[model samples]
Every structure is written in structure tokens, then in C-alpha cells.
Target: MRSSLMRSLHAAGLIDYYALLIHPLTLGSGARLFEGPAPLAEFELTGSVTTSKGVIIAYYARH
Candidate 1:
């Protein structure tokens, strides 16, 4: 799934930028984006967008 792909990319040091679509809902419990122990990496929020459905698409670039 998407988490696997993201984890792979992160492990391989291939994630330079991220575009995450955040839906406007909480399921009470779910998977974490950066799960478990990981090296500290900094990212700067470059931009974002709020869709008509209240979904937020956030853009970030590794710093």
C-alpha cells in the first residue's frame, strides 16, 4: 500500500519532496505516517491547498 511505498522511498533516501492529501475525517485509530523509530529529517512546508470537500493537500520539501 501507500505506507509501504513511502517507507521504501524513505529507506532508500529517495524522498526529496512530499505531496500529502489529508482528508477531513478521523477514524479514532489508524496508521501513523512516520511509524516507529526513524532518523530525524527536516521538511519545510512549501505550500498547501484546501479542496471543496475540506481535504488539505500539503506540499513539503526536504530541508
Candidate 2:
């Protein structure tokens, strides 16, 4: 999903959890997942796993 839409949904309290896949690579710079100014929110890491290919599947619950 687009960052804008995600931000909107989060701001409206429509999001309960987040499942993110993190790759073990990075370029010099790129677009961020959460862009621009947004309401402050907290999340707790509920679970996570690492794939054989070094990908991290992380789960977080909103607080």
C-alpha cells in the first residue's frame, strides 16, 4: 500500500497491526515507508522470523 493511504488509515485508527517484510539490503537513499508528518503512534513487536535469504518478517501490534 502507498504511504499516504497507510498514513491516512493509521490516523483514522483503522489499523490494528502491521506485518512488514524487511530485506537485508539498502541503497544510498530511497523512499521511506512512513513519509511526511503524521500523528504519533506506538507499536510493539509481537513476532518476527528470518528467512533463509536473510529477509525478516516482522509483526507489530499497535498500542
Instruction: Report the lDDT tens digits of candidate 2 across residue range 1-63.
Output: 888888889888788999999998878888777677767788899999999999999999997
Please name the candidate that would achieve the greatest TM-score relative to the true structure.
2
TM-score of each: 0.84, 0.87
Worst 10 residues of 1 by lDDT: 34-43
lDDT of each: 0.87, 0.88
Q: What is the lDDT of residue 63 in candidate 2?
A: 75
Spell out the clash pairs found in candidate 2. none
How high a TM-score does candidate 2 get?
A: 0.87
- Please give the distance, in angstroms, between residue 21's alpha carbon in candidate 2 and its true position after superposition: 0.4
